[model samples]
Target chain A: MASVRNLLVFRQLFHKETSTYTYLLACKQTMKAVLIDPVLDCVERDLKLLRELGVQLVYGINTHVHADHITGTGKLKQALPDCKSVLGSKSGGRADIFVDQSERLKFGNLMLECRSTPGHTNGCTTFVLHDRAMAFTGDALLVRGCGRTDFQQGSPSTLYESVHSQILSLPKHYKLYPAHDYKGFSVTTVEEELAHNTRLTKSKEEFIKIMDNLNLPYPKRIDESLPANLICGVTDPVSS
Target chain B: MASVRNLLVFRQLFHKETSTYTYLLACKQTMKAVLIDPVLDCVERDLKLLRELGVQLVYGINTHVHADHITGTGKLKQALPDCKSVLGSKSGGRADIFVDQSERLKFGNLMLECRSTPGHTNGCTTFVLHDRAMAFTGDALLVRGCGRTDFQQGSPSTLYESVHSQILSLPKHYKLYPAHDYKGFSVTTVEEELAHNTRLTKSKEEFIKIMDNLNLPYPKRIDESLPANLICGVTDPVSS
Candidate 1:
């Protein structure tokens, strides 16, 4: 078993088409790794990256049920036989393992603390690595902007509460990595989000107004992604 | 009713994420149109374009079952009550309407001739319009490079034969429109494809070798796209 602090491998990968950020984490000694918020369109790229790093994928984790794109967890689970698929219990009860907020997922001697962050979607979860070094904030929080709360069971008040207590309460240095970003911005810290977040900087009332006024078009593949994601991206024998 | 040559409304729309070219053809006088290879992700964009152009969507057509992206035909049918979905009978029996080679599709006063171009897929069809003024050659023919015939029931000899008899036999000045193109190059003429297509210009044996050695990875969303597209992008209540 590898010590959690000794050797950690973390790579943040971006899928240009969808502007999605997939995180790869591994323990050097065990060669076991975990992937977070994988996109269906970038599976080969992710697999190639794992091969180059000489790591064996063991877990596929989802921050939430994404609306803009299909999750690659199902595909990864099929490709890597030993890999287990995981998502929050609130996230529609799909995946091989449905985890709750207090549950910590362990892989190669390292553990990820799952925190309920259900604003962007009813099942969104933020995963905190050992000692709160970094957090995967899914759509709940972005660098300078928070996820839009206009649809998919989203509530502006709930998002504000989730971010303030569950995320902002962490030590200011803890890094915040979000699942999607359209602009070229990278990771941000709790301190920076607290000070500079465009949406979070506003009061709760203002945040609600902003959410109501966004008027953004529904995501491109929402119709296809939602239907396929509900079944974990596998063929429905009867449907065909 | 508009004359076929005097009042043709054709717009080639591009989906940047997938680099797919969706063609919208209409009779300007009747304001009736049909869309070819409509992408699921761009349904809203397509609908908006139709509304802006003040044309009534009468049909959504597929050149074949796509592996790269989900078709928007199913969603378009739901949005536009009058729209009908069409595909080649060999592609699968999922679409609302299926026609074989020699069938002419009519919308308003214009008609498109269906020609079998099966090499990339068993059901691939090339559509010719207005005395072969233009043709939508799906994956059978590309601009500077023809589609790779390594999978999906592909055969180099079949592609060569099909292109020669159905596409190349047309007028030299006929415009060639492909379903998808990664490079920026757009419509090419039959004469240009005969001269410049890297794959088609080769002999049958040489073309087979090129396809075998191309070594392209399987599409990222094949698993999800294939199953969903097989059923015309409709939601399977049982699966979901």
Candidate 2:
């Protein structure tokens, strides 16, 4: 186990337009970094911040193929020659690296254990940094709210199982960072979610009914976001 | 000094309408808590979170008398009978407790050292929790930006000196949490602000010039917010 010396450099960046969160994490000692769920519109801002922090970008990883905004991973690769675009193997999104369940991705001295947490989408993955007790849960589990399992191969039963097994099962104190938050909440703990998650705390059948009854409007940007995201947000849609 | 055992329980709550950040800090061992810069619009949400956390409300502190939005201190005091409304002595606002520069306010086992960082507003203050290397900079220093010094006794020269002497003087790695963020930035470090703060990084003259030329529109809520905030956001305007 690593000593409690605070070896990780972390920053949470937000995209106001889509209410998306992009995280930048770097290994302090090696200056190797990864950007989780970067947005296409804020790549310049993210890049400037990365440069100011003086960290080298190793990977631009997305938690899933988003339905609201395009990913910045492709544009990031174009800017950072050494950066790779990463996504879950089941995500069906083209990327430089396709991570699978239980795969451990390494950067500097830090290791991210990727847990396949599908149901919000089959490719939704939560990256857990066990040493720090932090998990970047894409849309599988949100603060007090879980993702809508209404589109893109979403299944309420599967999402419920994935969250309970892969995310909620983590240590209670683990800090969970979600992909998007409309409210002003920045982070939530597994402990808090366990006690307060509006939907997931109910019986599985109740959860299914709740998911089914959500009368949400179709995502406004779905048409544009889905296609662009599938090709890793590149206009030309070419694999690296 | 306390041992490094992660003793403080922290949560950053946001008000979307005003772009205000209300921070909740609690002593894990004592279960005593304080909310810094709470917004009037989110009192229900804040109270619910406090109840869920199982912490006793010690103080509801505002960093200043805001013009953009009303403070939640008054409403919080009404909701949490034991909670006191707190503000800077210079704020000229009615509050249960008036703190001044260099005063240490205690909540359970945690101590917040108050530093007056005026210029954004005469009463604008920054609360530093030295043990955790965290500073709640209320509208004084922002991420790559500083509060506009053009209203309510706002002086560019004073703001520059206040920031350089009080906030920027903190340890370089100390995380700075601002009261409001228009952009999606949640927090910044002292080091980053020193290096990249567009206004503060410049000379006093340049900063003054920048502040002078910034033809920002009049604050829409100032007329309503100023009067209500002066009495700590109570419609009745009575101090507890």
Candidate 3:
């Protein structure tokens, strides 16, 4: 663990109420870091931890515009003047930098490859480090289940294509980090998701049928969250 | 419980991740209900429950401006056209109706007496059902503790005075309902709090010391939640 800490300082933080996961990745030498899928509620906590570790934050990367929680990007940028906010190119005009597939976001000596995965939301992106050491799947891919495709311009067909072509195509050992999990398991491998993912393993039609019948309730914060998130997290300028 | 249900068709709903509580109080005769401290995520579930119970929602009332989650008042109004959004008068003209102390919110043969309970926030209100049958204490008083007075216009002296005069002054058996409780207990009595509340039992100076040293992490959703809540949970009119 100590040796790995030196290789790439990584930390997975959890917001217990929303079951959201935020990943922090830092280059050990330069202490330059970026947070992925940050929850607005934990900005102070995240910033405090970064300060304690002597890391200067560079970016707050949202996997997509989330429905369940608000993003911390605006607040983070307010606190740290140098830190930029990143999202997928299709995320409208929300963040500071929006990258497309195959694009890379570099922080110090570390680099994360962006892959377009638009199923759960039209702008969902998977961020993977060099050599596929880890892939931050956001909500498109979860532990055993995937994100519900009932709303937010989500489609089963698009998700199936994205997960299969973009995620499973990688080496079997690439570690998977999801934005959320309710069952408490963390960090599944591409090999394991290939074998055990209840949603992704089914045929495309079956997957579609399953998603269609999920009858999931609407996310509570969607109304307020969606409107605020459309312009990144700077919501003070929101209009009714 | 069934007998009590007959008296007032009450339901205590819990949002597990954040430990926030929302209370539904409906009058059996008119089948009209009011929700206190409604979370944004549970609006659909709450509305569905109202549908199943054959009750029409009348008011979506908040105890105070929440930091952890978005309020459901705006969404509820959108879903049920007749429902009104209620908040404290000091809420800066954010809610549909600004209620002051001693104001009566009546529906179907039921009435809740609103009492100004400041300190947690300048606008915090405690609603007392007819004849002091129950008191929604909100953050001013928790099950065994109280809301942290470090932010959101919180003050230990104000909270202490509010608790003793506005809350603790009620009969010993007046059941207490709070906006949040991490310990999983649903309800507590004024008598129970008088004996067990860690903060209220202390002297005013000691209580202030305890609140000052909490050193709790800033709530994750404060930035988004505060701004959105200040406008009665309507962030759609939000601008960048």
Candidate 4:
């Protein structure tokens, strides 16, 4: 095994139709990086940041097709021909790499273990960076509340299982990084989430009852976002 | 002055797009009624409610040209031909009766005093139902927070004054009924708003700072909502 030296995480705030957070994670020793859940319009800025940091974009990974903002994986790959677009196995053939649950990707000295946590969406996945002890748990687990389970292919039961059996079962020290938060505070611990998360801490029955009662309407940008996500965030030229 | 009598305050939730709340104020003896911020889709519903309650609809008043939902005053007039559509003096010629600050509209035994409370929108007004000891504040005051002062010619300074000097200056016991609330808590009071509203309680400098820091992207339905509001919720056949 190669010796891991330094790891860097870059996050960008894109206040699109809804506020979205996109991240770039890089292994300093190898200069290899992965882009996660990036917004389409912010690809150039991400690419610029990569160039400035001397990181080579290796993979564009989407946790799930977002309902609020269009994903930028396809455009990022188009702009950087060497990069591969990856999604979970259940992502319906929309990805270059169909990653399975618990699959591990090794980049130089760093290893990222995929954890299939499909509660927010059917194909939602959390990426656990083994070396950094950090997990990027997209919309599945927000700081105070969980992602609304009343839209698309969301299910409260699946979310309960994902949070309890997969995420909370992880090492308590693992830092949880969510995809979107208006407040600047980004990283939290699995222990803190387990203790404080209003949604996750509830009993499965209580959770389902609460979610059912919420009856949150569909995201306002769903109509505009789906097409872009389907094409991997490539906007139709005419619309753009 | 007409003899003081029992005041009946009725509210009907209308327009899901904006969750607009329309109110009917009637004096128990006279049955003469005044409509406030009626939704366009709920005109028939309002009529049904009025007829069922044995009340007469005499006046249709709008607090402001709303940005979240279309107003039903025009359709309401088409149905209740005898009722007059009243609005703020600065409604840009969309209202049948343009009323100014402190303009009082008397309906038999009930009296409604219109107070200019601009901030959420330029011509926004709040109706003080003096007889009911309640004020229909529309979007000017909300539970826990105030309306965003970032769209449709909104100014934080104007909002600060509107709330502090206009709405907050009212009698402490005056109950407030806003136009929209997702939680279904239909009413709050001036004292409650003053104490609990996060947005309104801030100092002018702090309020501006908070507003500046918001840097929030436009609301999802701004384009869809503004045009409908501008024409006082009357949509052209082509657009609808």
Candidate 5:
């Protein structure tokens, strides 16, 4: 007999070249699955795992139009014809489904509440699994650091508010999974981030000043990534 | 208002330089924790996380003495004076507690059943958290792959037997976490691996042949890692 208490099937995958984290989540009973932030280079790997798990890929969801690696949603749709490509409407990216703020996306017996968290990008959204007390934070809130606010419609003040109001206000113990982590941390809690987020924990004025002074070099792949991502990562010229 | 059903607190940490994974598991009620496969370079990071989580470190266990990276168990013992260093007795490594086959180590409300699954190394052991239906496979088994059998007393036949008899025999749904993954996979299931493990799925004779012909290059850090690990990864000349 299967246990009803633990019905969420979850796996965390990585793309080493880009330091991206792709998540596979499914409802144990129905095996209906969703892939959050899949990477273009890992489409085959993702497809193989999905097949092995025997889960039906209902949605290939991206948290935002990534500036690093191209999104795998388009490729995933090609592999699984029934799977829909999903993105935030504000992202200015094409998708089969453009979700709005506070929208509920259901797969199997689980529901994910989409919250717009646009500090990283206008379309950046955090998907919250309320019952599981987990949030797929994308770039809004990393383990101890938030995303850079220098590009892709980024704003320090806007990001600051988005994180505090949309993410931190959740229960202190809620697990936050980020899109990318260079330090190897897989997950963090709202409580830990509230206490130690190097950038976001500071006053808004200080945070703005810090983000302003970062002066980091432009992302190496932004030009290619942004355009590719706008089309939902479809590389084939004939179809995309 | 704490939920009694979800008393286990878990985190999967990674060390990018070596592609190693360190896991933190604790009993929520008692706040007693154990770290599996900690790396020397990430000691400070691990300690800070432990302090922030407000959990007392009880045991620092190593799945095996790694050839790729030095274990952080000794450094952890130095920082958390109450925490004991644990390793398999067959591993021939010095530790505060040398667990034997079928030994159960208790930390708060949880117990890990250590099963000797040596093929990657004589001391390799897989720790199974029975309640959670998960196993931490050191190097004997990996995601669709197994550890290289070119050196460090590696024997493909022994590994095949260990994986098939000891690890694979667990319930099919049991999740298996490996000590290291180069391709960005974090977890797999007994069923998935049984169907997909490239090397172990082969017959013992074929598996041995494949391993023998791997012709892999010598591990770059093995010379330094082995000696340091034998002493539990403590580099200080005075205390060690």
Candidate 6:
């Protein structure tokens, strides 16, 4: 078996009480790594973890323009000027690299293949580390339910298609890492999500109907979250 | 049996997704009315209801400075320019008539006795319609739980004191009308609240411990809602 490496998950609670999760994937042998969906203040803790793990931060990737918490990508980039900030081309944010669907990202011995999901938002993406049999599904496929599709250009049908065609098609054993979870339970699998997720388990039409019935009121922080998220969690510099 | 007027409860879903409940209490014979925690946009509908019921809108009261939706007190004042905007003095917002603990506000045949219940905020108040055997408890008390004490300068101990001293002291038969509830179930009695409310039923120390354990994250719209609520729910200058 290939040598085991330490993967650290940093979860940060943000904004009026919302929880955000950030992941650090590293290969012990080469000490190269990538981060996903990181919160701004948690970057310091992540850097500390990186130093202790003897890992070199190489890339930062955001799944989408999150509507709950500020992204830490820009701040991380500022701290580690050499590291590249990467995101899906449709993210409409400033990034070192605008990745497209099926784009493979390498970190020493590890590989993360980006898959466009686009259900919760117009530009949502899930990164699959094929070799490790792991997939960071972000907000696309949550444990028991699905991300809401009532705001930020979210389409229930499109999300359903993204889940079935893009995420579910992956290896059944691939471990899923979502963005936010109240319970400490961190990981699940494609098979589990397909079977238990109330939102993803339904037929596309049924999913739409279910989503329609579960029509939640607009997110309380949408106006505040979207503007910051659209800029990849960076507030525009105000002129003095 | 004394002639009874059916007690009516109003639930108004407001903001992009947040729900707010406003109530209208009326004496069927005298046609006098009192408004509780009114959301601005729903004022017109409430006025229409009052017209249909032949009730005069005499007083407007707010539960607290809401962090989800704007209050309709100012709007109602504009519609009925002579109507009094009544509220607790601690609300930190301007009102035509500031009420204090046990202060009885008379409206023709109905009487609303103010009860200071500071826990959700320093100024939160509940209105007891004494003669009708009803009380508008607002966020301080919910069916199975109490208003969270982690926001807007909330204190668990203060909440405990308010519950024990102000609310629980009321007569067992007094019905409760909260400012927000989605289940369409309205009106819980003082006896029910004292017995069933998880937050209120605990001993002072136990209640504090439970609240401490709750350490809830902030409300989603707090940043947006506070400014509006601070101004008595007026986002802009009142239009004549």
**Per-chain TM-score of chain B, candidate 2?**
0.96
Candidate 1's C-alpha runs over 4 A off are A1-240, B1-3, B237-240
DockQ of each: 0.01, 0.77, 0.02, 0.01, 0.82, 0.01
CA lDDT of B14 in candidate 5?
Answer: 93
Per-residue lDDT over B95-177 for candidate 4, one digit per residue giving the tens place of the 0 to 100 score: 66878898999886778888888877878888887766788887778755677788766788988898888788988867788
Q: Which CAPRI quality tier does the interface of model 1 achieve?
A: incorrect
What is the C-alpha lDDT profile of model 5 across A147-199, one tens digit per residue? 99999999999999999999999999899999999988999999989998999
Candidate 4 per-residue C-alpha lDDT over A1-240 given as tens digits, one digit per residue, 9 for 90 to 100: 444423553333343335466767777677888887877767776676667557888888888878888788878887888888777776553777877798986654567899898877888888898666778888887755678788767899999999888778889877777777543234566877777676778899999999889966767889988767756775455765
The complex in candidate 5 yields a DockQ of 0.82
Query: Across residues A153-187, which tens digit of lDDT does each residue of candidate 1 receive?
Result: 89989999999888988898688888976643446
Q: Pick the candidate with the highest TM-score.
A: 2
Looking at model 5, the pairs that clash are none
Q: What TM-score quantifies how close candidate 6 is to the native fold?
A: 0.48
How would the candidate models be sorted by TM-score, starting from the highest? 2, 5, 3, 1, 4, 6
Tens digits of per-residue lDDT for model 6, A1-240: 544322332222111145455777777567788888877757675676566446788988889888877787777776787788787787676677777899999887778898999978878899987766778888888755668888778889989999888888888767777786543234566766766676788778899998878857767767877776676665454720
Model 6 ranges off by over 4 Å: A1-16, A235-240, B1-240
> Chain B TM-score for each model?
0.95, 0.96, 0.94, 0.89, 0.96, 0.87
**Each candidate's interface RMSD:** 14.8, 1.2, 14.0, 19.5, 1.0, 19.0
Kindly state the number of residue pairs that clash in model 3: 16
Whole-model lDDT values for every prediction: 0.81, 0.91, 0.83, 0.74, 0.91, 0.72
Alpha-carbon RMSD, each predicted model: 17.7, 2.2, 16.8, 17.4, 1.9, 17.6
Query: Model 4 residue A13 lDDT?
Result: 35
Clashing pairs in 1: none
Provide the clash count, candidate 5: 0
Stretches > 4 Å off in candidate 4:
A1-5, A9-17, A235-240, B1-240
- Model 2: clashing residue pairs? none
True contacts kept of each: 0.00, 0.79, 0.00, 0.00, 0.87, 0.00
Give model 1's TM-score versus the native structure: 0.50
Docking class of 4: incorrect
Per-residue lDDT of candidate 5, residues B138-158 (tens digit): 888899999987777788888
Kindly indicate the candidate among 1 and 5 with the higher TM-score. Answer: 5
lDDT of model 2 at position A233:
78
